[model samples]
Target: MKNLVYIAFLLTFTFGFSQKKTESLKIQNNENAKVHFSDGPALFFTNSDSLILQVHPQAMLIDSLWMNKLIKSPLYDKEQYMLGDDEILVAGLEELPTDLLKARLKYLNSKTPFKIEYNPQLEQVIRTYLQKRKSSLSTIMERARYFFPMFEEHLAKYNIPMELKYLAVIESALNPNARSRVGATGLWQFMYQTGKYYDLEVSSYIDERSDPYRATEAACMYLESLYKMYGDWSMALAAYNSGPGNVSKAIRRSGGSTNYWNIRKYLPNETAAYVPAFYATLYIFEYAKEHNIKSKERAISYYATDTVQVKRQLTFAQINETLNVDIEVLKFLNPQYKLEIIPYIKNKNYILTLPIKDIGNFVSNERLIYAYADLEDTKVEKPLLELIKLDDKITHKVKRGEYLGKIAAKHGVAESNLKKWNNLKSTKLQVGQKLVVYPKNTNPIVTAKVTPIKEDKDETTYYIVKLGDSLWSIAKKFTNVSVQNIKEWNNIWSVNSLKPGIKLKILNLLNDQKK
Candidate 1:
């Protein structure tokens, strides 16, 4: 029954007014295309020459039916959100006076290129956000610290309005992995087609639309194109919500009107409410402090993260286990890896983003890390394609000087696997020892020599364990040292034994060599 009433009201708003063609308002192309509002107690609608509407704050306070209408808007709709998702919706906000709202909006209008005017519908939208979505908004605001700098950088690069950052809040609640019912995805809510149009690749292993930096850059380019098409940010936003074709159709249906408000009712329901939600979000974020919308604690900033080109296919689990990084943090940083696996396809460069502190550790122990990942992959029930490509297997004849570690490094296979495959219990090798190997290089044979690790069991060293230290990390520090070897040598059977200040025995492989 309430939905019927809402529909009736929307229809009345859509078709009640007589058609009057007015010249389309074009925002000038300048650094600051500010739109100043006229001062008065009586607020004027855009089409004031034909109709006059007065602000009735006291009457609005008592109008239950009108308030119900406001509640029905998308701004108050929380049906689509999931818990722990970035979309913030606040409640229990104090009532904002009409005059104050007008003043704030006037200031906003003076600062932005978009037409931010005082209308009952817009007022309802803004008030809904302020009154009902406070906590969520605060959370989103806090979360913005992680992403907004990257957003601003890309927006500035494309000369896009920085306020458009709020569009992501409206679209995906700032969640990069957010996907809509209609299949629009990421922080920018791009559809498969639109994402592809902007060079956001979606493959079996990756979805670039969920990558914050890539998606933001694509969104800026897309929005810049939309603005050029319409010469107005409002319409561009509308077109982005729906499409240019829908906006064009709405324009035609509204007797050739170009104003968003004038043709809004002709647009799709979601698109009709889309721009208002954006504007409301913009207003809320801009005056967050004034309204006491305090931001929650922010996570790691985007600048604190860096990406490195992945040389081998690796799972988030492998990375987490190897690097002692939290799995959730890996997912958050590298959301584009669809299967949580970064693929190493030929000629295609895929990257893994990590907190800046992890980059050096990852790079320094990359070869061993890849070896560990390869060993780990062998245990999976259904291993990734790159792992068990039988076609890439090759044979290598072990020379007199060759050992398991040396051959493994040359072929990019795990040293542990060499022992398993050849049924060798020891590191001893014989001349002309034929070994089956799967080289990552995929060349029929690999002759590239790897600098061998000097094996010296005579010299022993003790390593005091540090906080957050794992066997994998500790093993990476020593040449030719495996976690299995560490366990056997130190008689440490479980990870619990790796308490801080505990000293673990290590063989100083290069003790006799000069630095």
Candidate 2:
């Protein structure tokens, strides 16, 4: 099978070669750390001897033939970022002469901290990407033109290596909505706790992790943080893929070798491939033209879109209904809003990114769009903490032997509520994960007959009214607090005259019930 050959080719190149029974090469600290062997182990290798290995292009090419006997999933089609997730084919690639490959790699001045080795394994991945995955590579290239400017800006802002921009391609194939099987989401594949640390809010209607611009910025910050922790980009990347704790353990296991290659064997299997994949991707992208790869036509140019702040809560349905803009494109442009609805709070800001041509239509008919229907009136899901205990604030630091269900029971809350409050897609918990608990309470009005929605007696929420927000709509958020209560709180006798940007304080308790 194609997979079998592919595995053989990779293993042969990456982890092959029998150790010589007598006087085999073994690598030691610093003296000959970079010595790479082609036929045997680098046991007892010292700086006094040569560390370079010469590989015949024809030999590798012949081996590549067996790996390309059959074509499997064009990895790009399934999900672009799943590296080594499918068959690798080099059958149709315009072969790069060994001398020319060495020449080109040397000629291309790369400015990354990670070592870009030109080995059979790296070449295998590059050739596979350029040949079998050419279509996907082209697509990624086209989209990169649209996304890279932002990536560069953020990378520069954080003083990170500009070459690190390719990380997004390897993380999510530039797809903002791309999610990993491990529940890491977005271009950077941030887990829920990591995303929360970066301040990417996830609610019923919005998930900022899928926002291209915001997520890129968060990724930059996170990468910079990792770099600070490890002081080496290669190790930082490894830590980024598999946490710093794992990398530290690997270092300890590798006898305290600071060099990534020396400690590479101790890293997780996937993580060992991670750095190589990144390097391979960087090489392919940098010399795409040399490999006869051309980027496909892009949907929009870098400046084709514009972002506008939404003064009020609005949905894709409402926007499409009024402005005639395709909601699908809106979703594509703004993938962060989980429900295609952007929530608006008076003191906070939310934006909708759309094509420049559509911005005019949106701005012109903003009022009609927000006031289009009663869709926003429906109750949206709140954070888990807000749905559980009635307290205003509670922090639960994960302890040993604690699970979500157990934690929920201890707090007298539902397990599902815990996940939502934490924006966790799974129940896996670390020993020290800090969870915020927003206590939920039912505050049914003690009225004669009409029982409205329940509220938390100890809590208060605020809202800002735009052209479309109304007393009736705002009242829906509370159990018994109605339009009368809103009018009384703000001293406003009329509803239609609500001014945009005016803050309204909402108390949770019904007036009579409180009394």
TM-score of each: 0.61, 0.57
Q: Clashing pairs in model 1?
A: 88-136, 89-133, 89-136, 90-132, 90-133, 90-134, 91-132
lDDT of 1 by residue, 1-515 (tens): 32354456546644663353222211112221111112211111122121111222232223323322222223322333222224344422356788888999999999999999988888877877776677778667756877898899899888888899988888887777776767787888889988898888998778999899899999999999999999999999999989999999999999998899999999998888888888899998898888989865435666656779988898775675466555456766787876667999899989998865466557765764675666545433332324334666778998866666567766655554565566664344678989987654332322223234455556877789765556765764555555655655665533334555889887664432111
Off by over 4 Å in 2: 1-81, 85-94, 373-515
**Model 1 residue 393 lDDT?**
70
The best candidate in terms of TM-score: 1
Q: Among all windows of ten consecutive residues in candidate 1, which has the lowest summed lDDT?
A: 35-44
lDDT of 2 at 462: 75
lDDT (CA) for every model shown?
A: 0.67, 0.62
| Each model's backbone clash number | 7, 11
Angstrom error of the Cα, residue 315, model 2: value is 1.2
